[model samples]
Target: MTGLAKPQGVKRMQVVIHAGAAFTDDGRLLGSLLANKAALAQSRSLPLGPRHSRQFVKVMSDSVIKDVPVDDAQEDLREIFPEDLNAERLIISSDKFFGPRRTALQHGQIYPFAAKRTAYSEKLLEGAQLELFVGLVNPGSFIPKILMSLHEDQRESILGSTDLSCLSWLNMIDDLGDLAPGVKLTLWENEDTPLIWGDIVRAMAGLADDVALKDEYALLLSLLTGTGKTQLLELIQQGTAKDRQSLRDSLAGIFEDHAQPEQIEEELDLPGWNSDIVSAFSELYEQDLAKIHTMPNVRVLHP
Candidate 1:
């Protein structure tokens, strides 16, 4: 791997870290940001691909966990981000940044170490401005999926004595606020991603409102039928959806009629779970979102 050089006498480094709540995104967010690399570069923003992200995680682990010197850690960063790149802002993303799936429900709750992790990363970045973006999934769907990702023997151990009803994404956000209070935090619901996909990408890239992007509809397109895709392209080509809001409104209308059933539907087959439990979880998630909106220093993107 190439070494990163410490940036000097350039723009103050701004680091955007996309910490995924597991099952929310599998690099699709990063992929979307990457699709507009040329556009991002025009604004002096660099989005690190998976290789750089992994290198970053390794450096952070070595520095914080293995007691490597801060200087050494900064040197390792030089490999991931060359000094000559001179980018003003850097974007790094990984779902595992929040911790592996097995560790997600630690301490009888979700991501209890999240705040400390964020703080450690900030410190290791040599005081770069920190921004965190995360997408939250309703536990009704999130829990079962995460549980399924784990080994059978490991599942019960991680979830010991925790009440499913008590799991709250807001609690995790609150911890971030209290511990890494200086970090800018951005959040959105996974379900709302398709609708707010453009906004999410623009926010992460710090792109101007008037700036345009390619593949903005990639995620939304993946979930649509051929007919839906054709209709959407026509809508855009004809300039029917003049603004962001109007485009989103048009997509909503199209999705209602043409979204693929299997792609949009989340299957739940966990033991002792039913429609009622899922509905209750969805209700709690909505309530948590309301409280999240009121949080200071946090930006919640909506459709």
Candidate 2:
């Protein structure tokens, strides 16, 4: 794999493809071929005959917006626009779409077509250099569902961060991979982890007609991660045969109500104790249980 010399200011563009249709099997195959061809063509195309610098045009996807500036107009168009209009320029065409919805584009300058028209009502045509062309394409059945799962607020936050432009182009792709896996693990481990420890405490207290479950819930809160909860539960189980059985039964009942048996098994099979889960426990401890004893109808059975 030959490394393409990093283009000047290439680090500024960190575009991610959130639209699911962009990752189809055919799309992947085509994109791979295009990337390779572009890379190879770029190397040979350099070192112009009479003019040492050659004018080259490259078509990039919306993912490129992550690294490139989208907010500041000057910075966003620096590479594509002429430094000196007289100088022989390299025209790079970025096929990025800016819309009101969540996109990989990080720069603030490029507004969604609708936003551009609204914000700069009169200057829309004069200020906007790029034209948006929409085509009817089948984006797959699950595309809408995937977009919906990525909440609008969270998506907007990620897309709107100015610091996001500093992120490496490669890292943006890696982040998408990490996000899917992280969410999947979170779902799988929901049973073992104390994600809903408060609800469990309330339910148990109501059912048992005793507030002792609140203390147990507080203890369980300290074990927020799957590994921590699993290990802590094991330690508690070792106290006595009766204690072990009782604790196991309580946990099993809670798990059954919240998650499927397969999910519990999957959580158990996951490797290692991630520190992020520990941090989650710390956050919950600070935010939710700062004054656990002061709460009404709550009893402290175990610290």
Full-model lDDT for every candidate = 0.82, 0.29
Best by TM-score: 1
Candidate 2, superposed: residue stretches over 4 Å from native: 1-72, 84-96, 100-131, 139-145, 148-303
- Residue 293 of model 1 has an lDDT of 90
**Candidate number of the best lDDT:** 1
lDDT of 1 by residue, 1-303 (tens): 122324476456788999887777788889988889998988888899999998887778656667777777777787787747658789999887767677787665678778878888877776478899999888888888888788987887765656767887877888898889889999998888887888888899999877788887778889999999999889978987777789888988888789999998988766777889889999998999889899878899987
State the lDDT of candidate 2 residue by residue for 1-303, as single tens digits: 001223455432111111212222222212322333333233221111111111111112221333333233333234433333221111111222223234433443212232222222112112222211111111121123223435777644654564321322223222322332211100011223233333332221122322222234433434245655564466445654355346556555544454434423312111232445434444543333334334342332221
Q: How well does each candidate superpose onto the true structure, as a TM-score?
A: 0.92, 0.21
Poorest lDDT segment (10 consecutive residues) of candidate 1: 1-10
Off by over 4 Å in 1: 1-10, 67-69
What 10-residue stretch in candidate 2 is worst by lDDT? 181-190
